[model samples]
Target: MSKKKNKSKTLKNEPSSLHLFDQIYNNPHFHDIVFLIGKEETKAYGHKLVLSMNSPIWKGMFYTQEWMETKGREECLVRIPDLDPKVFLGFLEWIYTRKAKISHTTIYGIYKLAHKYCMPDLKQYCTVRFRKILNGRNCLRHAERSVIEGISKWHKISLKYLMQNSKKFMNNGKCFAGLREETVRTILEMKNLNCPEILLFRALKYWAENIQNDLIKKNKTEIYERILINPDQKKITARKLVKKYLHLIRLDLMDFKNYNELIKSGYYDHRILLKEGFNVVKKFDLKAKTKSRSGPQLSDSKILLIGWCRSGETHVNDLINSLKSGGIENVTHMDPTVSIPSLKAMQRYDAIVVRSSNVNSFYKGGNLGSNLAKYVDEGNGVIVIAINTLINNPEKQIRGKFQNQNYIPLKIAERERSEQCSLGKVFKPNHPIMRDVKTFKCKEYSHFIKTNDLNGGHIIASWDNGYPLITEKRRNDNSGIVVCLNFHPISTRITNDCGKAWLQETDGNLIFSNTLSYLIKDKLSKLAQKNPKKKIFYKK
Candidate 1:
């Protein structure tokens, strides 16, 4: 009979299995289980079979003897205490139709519900969604939750975001005060926080004041300030409120001026401030997570002086004394003829100052020029004083090793002259390296290593013959600073047998000291750029 000529037709009039389950979700007539949820006790309907198939917790609860005994009773209801109705409703929807409605407002609640119900897939989905919606405004809250839930990944990501926007978060009055005490302590404990310590202290003060005021209100007191008496007759003060987290701040690393201001503010106890002051003075903090977040100060920076340090000569000693007078106290003298430090050892210094009366010693130990070039590339500053060498001399070996340094910012040629009246005229007097440097006195017959090609460096000062005296060039990648002083090292102030031909005045000292200061400032500025704050040049 040709199989009764059966016709194949689409079932367009009926809903699919998933769509039918979704349509009947939360309908009391079709669901066997009724969930009374939240403080409002809102009702959510769920099918036992559908819930049991999705979650083992639901499966075990539904198959219990107590639930089986009341299977046919209409009064049987599952009470989901302390859960939002919307969150429970979303959970039921996922069980029935494999879809969830997730938003920022309900995500945290939904995640908790999913975790409580032993739903790994839903928990993973929520974790991915958390990453997408995280920002500066919500990072602290999310980080707090992550720590509680032991979710290490989101905790790290959230804290990293907090560190990036720490200046804004700490400076904003409302946001800073609204943070929970534990959350505030967690942020304070971070090692890489680059915000100023004074701002952190102020935020802590605001947070403590708010907490103290809240305690006062709870005790039915009229106190507006931080000091109040609680119901148990215990005194509440700002210091007591912030005592647990106070020591997390690196008080030793803060500027002494700011530390004094913190003491004057009177938010913390005098004993705490005194102890921190002791730590600062002793250069010792056993609890400090870092030495300095903003990079080394001029006093803390190490300078490598590679030059002649003869017992009777003051050429290198003069430079060292001037640098120390300008707050650069850590200068190490390394005679190039004796030994040249490894590149790894050279990285320990913030800058290197190279001055030599004889260029032959540069190639004595190792490749000093190449190591210096690599040092500058690794973000350290270099100052080259080529005043003693003769660039036009027919000595190829001496001149070749000196001229091969790519880190030198200028091209040296045969454009030099010996003149006793070759005074330095400041072109960029406002420049940091030229600060307080008007004119430097030239010693008797000082050799001027004049250069016409500056190689894109700015002339801070010049010879009377229009040659570049002191030129500054920053690396193309902004990694380091190079300052070239095109005058004889004999022009430096010294007191020795050859003091007649050497410099012996304050102008030379002021210029050299200012040049070292400028290089350190530039180096710290570069280090600050690696952090999250806006690029700001370190002001003298």
Candidate 2:
């Protein structure tokens, strides 16, 4: 009983760990070190033992061989250049008390210091705190500043986080000022950026103008005299600031109104516009073609055709002709079986069409389909044509190929067999793909593949037996579009042939053209809506 009572008293008398830290922090009477930080030579106090224990940098400074011979037992003075006194104080407080006050203004500085001092826990704490403070209003400023001042590793982390989470903030025009040229180019290159290309141009213009104004303010008399001599020189000088970054912007993505406004605003040089071969009259003519019932014509869009085509086969050629007839201007055919292009090369095209004779071989070759799925996620368009061989063996061919990919819209059924082609009914008659399309006709022995709806994909057209024949899925925010046609839309058949390819003049051709048009139009329309007005340019 007496021992138990003694133990209870001992427990009551002992202080908690936090209380001990607070006591150590409050008792500054025996501080043995002083850090002079920043230009003002501000002093920060801490115990050498505590500092050395918490920071490897401090340990090296106090206990290394040279230090022990010079100033080991004496009071030590260290200078930290360019570091804010308050930030250093926060660091010291954390070292002594296991707690520190962190805010937006001080977070980056503290993170830098913590990294330099090899304090992983403190660095992690600052990183978490900084992420929490990121929002639509402040993300741009934080990102710009971090890139400008952070180390390479920290810069990468900050940029990756901003790209994934702070897209809304990047849309604000004010965020563009004072950015590095490489940073601006990187942002423009992102496929999934929510901002329009035109707005990005305006932002680049604003930044260039601001940089010129700052230069003029700093060299007031010289610049003023030069400008007075040649009034056009000011415009020339401002354009020079952003010239290197200009070509990275995709001028083709801009609509007619926005493109015209950019030209008239005098933000870019006439020589550069001419070099890009941008003719105002041609642009206007192209805009006029967007009003067709097939939806907007993709005259400026680039389409990539991937797969093999035999010399005598007219299916691929016929489809290409149909697309060209519907006003698509640029189409490149590539045989992925020969050599799969890199993702960067693939991104040059606006839409991708994949046709494979052996679906299993295509799936196993260099992760092409998965990479294409990533491309689709970045606000592009994809059309996948599953051949009869793939459809007839859904388990071994279709599901096996696409088991790990989410880009395919349809889920394959277990049972796979060939069935006589029946007349297909328009599942959604009002859908853009079915705008002028009525009954879909196909050749006999054209295998009908069964599919389940996946990724919110709805049946755009179905067979008379109610099996889905066509599926369409649009991603969130309309970032991308995917359409899967179960049967070949383009075929080569003689007039008397029964089980040949689709007829060139059949409804299948029209539907295929309309689907391509709709996907391209949707992508362009969203780009136009990214920033609808010029007012955002004046925000800063």
Candidate 3:
């Protein structure tokens, strides 16, 4: 009688066969989902099953998604392939429910996927695994693309982390071993590869494979020529090379995806994806015979920052990113010591800005940084920051000077390791530079000395320290305004959520863009300057 009662109770409590409970144990996509072998995959991999991809799923598969959702985030089974079934399930349970766990193996797979999908958080998690197994040659290939793709995703990738794995990759990995010279040259010229030691390996790779034949041909040709034209064979960085060759893939470039359609549109070459990229500066005639009919032109009106050590891209991101977010992204950063091609890039800017830090780098007679000083006197109403050198190291001043000035030999420690913020923290709301920064936030980085040195300099803002935080000095009877000061800037605001919170969130670049707008409009009255203020929005 007890057995008969229990049987009746079970029949009453059982779910119908048509329900999701039956489907979960049967569906191929659901039941045999990829094995996530590792604590990371077991824990975070559950997100995949629950992912709300709106793309159509079959009506029959509806129950699969439903059951997975009902099971909850912490109670999923993630079995590793080729493992004892019971053991793997038990390990997955520990990881998902925090009961027991397994070693990490699915990390490399997930990391590559995370990178592809622009998952910043997940990519960071993969970084830990990459760093942990830096010595393991087994994972370098997967790891290399992970870092590269992540760098392509973020505004500026910190290479310090990847440097640790360099030696391990050099030991015996095919990814490092079989790297083509064109590929090596591409990375080097793009400024993507990091570290001197790592750089040496890539250089060694390029020389051993790609450059060897080219070097012999070049030597023979040079010997045949009677005249010798002095040349400076510039060393291209991997990051820069990638930028020159690959279409701007900081994110993905949108060329037509359907290959056959693109070819059918009277185009010849379909192999080269992302059609709008070339080494413009490297090309003899800045134009390329792209398969796409669109011709490349003198583009990117880059703002050439002429400043002392105070602005090392510390805060310019806010303004730069803001305009970028609203279908109006213009500007790329170039520092004097870090990237000098920027000086030549100056031809691109519609109007120029001379910041306080810039003044010291160009002015201050006898200082190495002061060599560029003559331009500051031009004052095309160029917005100059209010200051001299951020620090008083004579050696630093010497290193700042150009090659002809005999300052190149003296290598002073740059502020690469130091954080310098101007003690002054106030701003005058009415200044021209302030015209664009609606955030009204002051910069907090170390600024060089602000001199009332110019007789006509206007004090637009000041800090509690009584130093001028923002000032603009008139030059040549207002032909230009040399902005000089130590006030906080909008760049700090852009990076933090103070102003716009999008455009990959770097230091205030959009504010810098707005400032450029103001300067350009101020210089050439005929030029149309868009309404003041950083374009506050998110781009991508």
> Which has the greatest lDDT?
1
The C-alpha RMSD in Å for every predicted model, in order, reads 19.4, 16.3, 23.3
lDDT of model number 2? 0.65
**lDDT (Cα, tens digit) per residue for candidate 3, span 1-540:** 999999999998886543333233222343423455544443223223332221123123434767558645443554444334434443223223322222245544554544444545545655554455544344434334444444432211212223334444444323444333333433333322223322233334333433334334566344222112123534423333223332322211112332233235322233443365633233322232212111111122344544334544545554344434322334555443432333334545544443334323433324323433333333333443322333345423423433223211111122221133322343566543454343332333343353333243456554344545455544444344444434333443435543212223332343344455455545543222332443421111
Ranking by lDDT: 1, 2, 3
- TM-score between candidate 3 and the true structure: 0.30
Candidate 1 — which residues are off by over 4 angstroms?
1-20, 39-41, 63-66, 73-76, 103-105, 145-157, 178-180, 219-234, 242-244, 252-260, 267-540
Which regions of candidate 3 are displaced past 4 Å? Answer: 1-301, 306-328, 338-345, 352-381, 385-432, 436-454, 487-514, 526-540
Please write out the lDDT profile of model 1 over residues 215-305, one tens digit for every residue. 6566534332323334466666677766666787667676666676677877556686566566555553444443334532455578898
lDDT of 3 at 321: 47
CA error at residue 514 for candidate 2, angstroms: 25
Q: Global CA lDDT of candidate 1, please? A: 0.68
Which stretches of model 2 miss by more than 4 angstroms? 1-19, 38-40, 64-69, 72-76, 79-82, 136-138, 157-172, 220-236, 241-244, 267-540
TM-score of each: 0.44, 0.46, 0.30
- Tens-place lDDT per residue, model 2, 329-368, is 5778776546776679888987787765533324344356
